[model samples]
Target chain A: MTSYHSINFAQKISKLDELWSPRVISEMNEYQFKAVRIQGDFIWHDHPETDEAFIVLQGRLRIDFRDGAVLIEAGEMFVVPKGVEHKPFAEEEVHLLLIEPRGTLNTGHAGGSRTKPNDLWL
Target chain B: MTSYHSINFAQKISKLDELWSPRVISEMNEYQFKAVRIQGDFIWHDHPETDEAFIVLQGRLRIDFRDGAVLIEAGEMFVVPKGVEHKPFAEEEVHLLLIEPRGTLNTGHAGGSRTKPNDLWL
Candidate 1:
């Protein structure tokens, strides 16, 4: 097993160049912690079995549900429930820490066009 | 089921007074997010089954393992693996976000004297 030192999220986020691509930073049991930079619109998708947690580290983000939307700013967090379809959008670039089960896809149900296959650790 | 709006971790943490007692802020699937203010020395303990994640939002924290210790600073995180006997100590007051299952107790095996039975939601 790989032992870990304490990790700095800000320092790791600074190293990322691609938007919407999530890099695994740490893991707890079966779950993985990911950091992602996103802007504009992301495809509408939902995980059928696992609930996804989104924590806004910097900037602003919006998760639009079918009937309404929730806006999350820095220092806030929101959990998108399982089987609930939602689209994530950011007018400006937003940094996010995502929590989900290991091997879970970013695009969820909708893939192909925007599916990012590679998962990196920082 | 209770639907959640985006939550601010900073604002919620600001309202805490008692140190070492954890408050539940959010939940995703079977897991829950908790905010805890800790200082000085904590009891040595270990969860027999679950892994615990510690994310330092402010100040500094150190987790002393049997062999070595991990020093976590602001914007940093560390995961204490299952069944590892560890002691958490912070020279200064540290703001922490802890992730675990819904009914996890702060003191895993060692309790009684330093056990906090009440769990609050902020």
Candidate 2:
């Protein structure tokens, strides 16, 4: 259930090191799910009008919500629904791909420290 | 651009023949993009609330819109925005996968001729 055909999750991790740089895997319409490498702490933010889904390719990632939190590991995924207040943090570098509508803003109500531009292909 | 790592587009086509049956490739959050083998004509319908995306894995598939039509081929993807009128047709067997919210309905405005149940693993 964790392994994907020819999908070398480890290989993808080898390709990048930046916190928010996403490399496109595939495109459906205007939306594309891309892989990224993250480490340490991330800015606190949320998407007011869009729901974002994250799938861990390697390592561990945590989404801190206003009330509770969710821990996602390799082979696991978590969806942050629209308008939820949250922040993402990682103890070590984690590789993940995010799926969401095109032109969605990375930061929702809290954008000062966490907003990221879209369509940066690795 | 056309091929995915360890991803077998051709092998998936050989596994099934029925229309609208989608097989999971990967999941992000609660949503998943699955590969499905489709053919002939589909029912006219629309998603009133959610936008649907289709990526042509093999063969040719057409999305009939209210005013015009969009043709998608292998390696190409199309997104049907919410509340749009559309019907899919294929001259031969067409393989594709849908990416959307987990509970999205296949038929938007029109249903009956088509309205597949969710979470059918291939």
Candidate 3:
């Protein structure tokens, strides 16, 4: 009856149907790990208090900063420091594993139509 | 002059020559993303204040608890709650991405000869 269970990112992400909407996969302490698939562009935003870690599972992601951009590929990871303005772009479908605090907003400071619930577990 | 760089887990791990030694790949907030290759047995230990997150990059990992055990596989993740005494075992070489606080010791409370410096970076 233990609640602890292992998560296979490949299998979990393959079952998702949405784009850019992250679903909580697991958690450790105050941090929650999420999975999301994306194509095209995500609005520029900034989270003033928390740094966000992104692990690329499939394809590639281009994170654009005011001064430059960083390309993250499969089996790779990138950490976007707090208080930094950035946008995400994917020329092709990309799968990602995001690690951050439990109550973090996906849209950061630019909450609007693209802002999705941060607590949806997969 | 930016210090930011994307880390490729597969490529980085392939360069390692030791076992059970973790290398820091990236950091977000106070937590760090580390990569390591482990096989055989790891001593039982506990981190009283911080939870440990383990994501298998390749191969499988078996975590043993006093009351139960959890088997983790490639592309899968598992979180060991804080203050829990546990040991890790791998039938073969296993690649892992460990997420925990900056000061976390891999050996946890079981510090001895098995304990290693927690700040090695890839």
Query: Which candidate leads in TM-score?
Result: 3
Tell me what TM-score chain A of model 1 achieves: 0.93
Per-residue lDDT of candidate 2, residues A42-86 (tens digit): 777777777787867678788887777777876455667677777
What does candidate 3's lDDT look like per residue over A1-122, in tens digits?
35456888988998889999999988899999999999999999999999999999999999999888899999899899999998999999999999999999999978999999779999
* Residue-pair clashes per candidate: 0, 7, 0
Residue B95 lDDT (model 2): 80
Highest lDDT scorer:
3
Q: Where does candidate 1 chain A have its weakest 10-residue lDDT segment?
A: A1-10
Q: Kindly report which residue pairs in candidate 1 clash with one another.
A: none
Tell me which of candidates 1 and 3 scores higher on DockQ: 3
Which candidate, 1 or 3, has the higher TM-score? Answer: 3
lDDT of every predicted structure (CA atoms): 0.89, 0.68, 0.91
Candidate 3: segments with Cα more than 4 A from true spot: A1-4, B1-4
The per-model DockQ list reads 0.57, 0.06, 0.63
Model 3 chain A weakest 10-residue run by lDDT: A1-10
Candidate 1 per-residue lDDT, tens place, B1-122, comes to 33448988888889888899999998888899999899999989999889999989889999998888999998889999999999999999999999998778899977777887645687
Docking class of 1: medium
Better of 2 and 3 by lDDT: 3
Per-residue CA lDDT of model 3 for B30-110, tens digit only, reads: 898888999999999999998999999899999998888999999899999899999999999999999999989989888
